[model samples]
Target: GLRVLDNLPAPSLPCEQDRLRDFMGRRERGELLIQKINKLQEKLLKKMQLSVSKDGFVHFGDTVMLLNPDSKSSVKNCPGACVRLTLAINLDEISIYSFKSLEAPCGVSAVESVDPVARNTFCILSVDGAPASEPIRFGQKFSLGTTGGASDRMLYLASDHKSFIRFAKKSHLQQVFLTDELSYLTCWQAAFLDPQLRLEHEGFPVP
Candidate 1:
């Protein structure tokens, strides 16, 4: 009886082994959860970049192409035909850089048909919609810098209550003041090369 008892394994050995196994399993699960959380955080950060500002303005400052209402057809046929417009916004002021046309030779440094025009600070104004007024009339307007302060440019950004669809139709702007409609066109259905790039109020791209 004594010899049999000596040959038997310790009674606490199996319990200790089970406890060690459980600890390892918990550690692995915890590491996996942490990895998943980190990935989720990264995605959220990317989305927060373009979130609406505290002032209820959805600001945009990136290399945006001004395409026609029929932008899909034009872009598909000839991407170079799209006019590129660069915007510089400093929360307090907005500047516009525009060229007549895009010219690319041998894929080298592209040239502009006309000298790039740099506009001074633009004034934004929001107009309330009348019962019969079109949605475009109710949105914000970026007053173009004119010699006599004529306020011609009316690139309507999306309003708080309106979807961006109204801005897509050219008919909406039939009565809207547009000295150069083609220059400030922003087609809603157009495809941007890298729309993810956003600008901060400090006039720099968000990393």
Candidate 2:
């Protein structure tokens, strides 16, 4: 992490431009969450209080990380599981980090996308290969980042809802999801948090 911080502009940002904006913005506000990061760079990148990862993770000089809110020492272990930190657009005070399941989910109803990438429409279902029971909405007022990017769409869902998909963008079997490594973490974060849509096996490569 210090090495990358020393390298600044060249530090690999695996995420899209939007995610970086939030980090840089918060640095301006002098938020404490970011202060912890700055303190890590006080000495040479090799001073090594904390180490930065190219993949979507941060670590202290050692491997075993222990965080205790009651102790100031815990700040070193802070940012747990969160890769790139950002403020929710609507919830300005909240921070979001991408987290991926260590293991894939099991026994959950499947979700698949019916919308083809060539077209902007995205229809989805949990069934093995059945047509949706309801009509598909051609477009929506909001977007995760890209208009037709499925992952971005899913990230939007994760951040915006209390009961994400309490009423899915559609009706039918669905629910829950969760995020990524350093450079790849943002998009991967969107992919995992995207509520675990189980596209048909045949469409394994669904957009």
Candidate 3:
């Protein structure tokens, strides 16, 4: 019916156009923020002095040390305590360096090494609650969880609780966070939160 249809009110056009414009604006902002996040990640990596390979392995010039918790206290009060982790090219081996003093010219000894086999028991998880599919880098948050246990009983680092770490239940994951420590990435959380982010200082940002 071609009967003079020109005067029909196209009421939805303005609303649809406004919605599309809003969507585009939001997309632009999101992209810009993502760029900023990338820059921040790079900056953090440089600050941590870590060399990560293309395949997501961390590279240490020398062997990695797995320090016993009891040995860490010896250097706890010493200035510039640091730790480093290195992974092998084939991803079959991992090394950790722990409790190294910045002031000392030589390596400080560690006592009572934990079983290296424990490494095989745990895996890293990303912020979105999935097994980490990508190589972990700076500015990203992660949690450590057991690989094959009942999914509900995984343990995670909970800095704020009376215990330094806590167990995760079926629907929850307590996490450890990273902080800048004299050019190293230490498992620490900030004392205060940024008001603008609206995130509570604890249990939110893993890094």
- Number of the top lDDT candidate: 3
User: Candidate 1 — number of clashing residue pairs?
Assistant: 0
Off by over 4 Å in 2: 1-94, 99-123, 132-207
Please list all clashing residue pairs in model 1, or write none if there are none.
none
Report the lDDT tens digits of candidate 1 across residue range 1-207: 454556766679889999889878867775445554443333212211122234432233321222223356767787766444322111111111121111111011112222222221222222222121112211233222111112233333221123455331333432222232323332222122354532212332122
| Candidate 1, lDDT over the whole model | 0.29
How would you encode candidate 2's per-residue C-alpha lDDT over 151-170 as one tens digit per residue?
23222112213354453332
The lDDT of each candidate is: 0.29, 0.26, 0.33
TM-score of each: 0.19, 0.14, 0.26
How do these models rank on lDDT, best leading? Answer: 3, 1, 2
* Runs off by more than 4 Å, candidate 3: 1-111, 118-121, 129-131, 147-152, 161-207
Poorest lDDT segment (10 consecutive residues) of candidate 3: 98-107
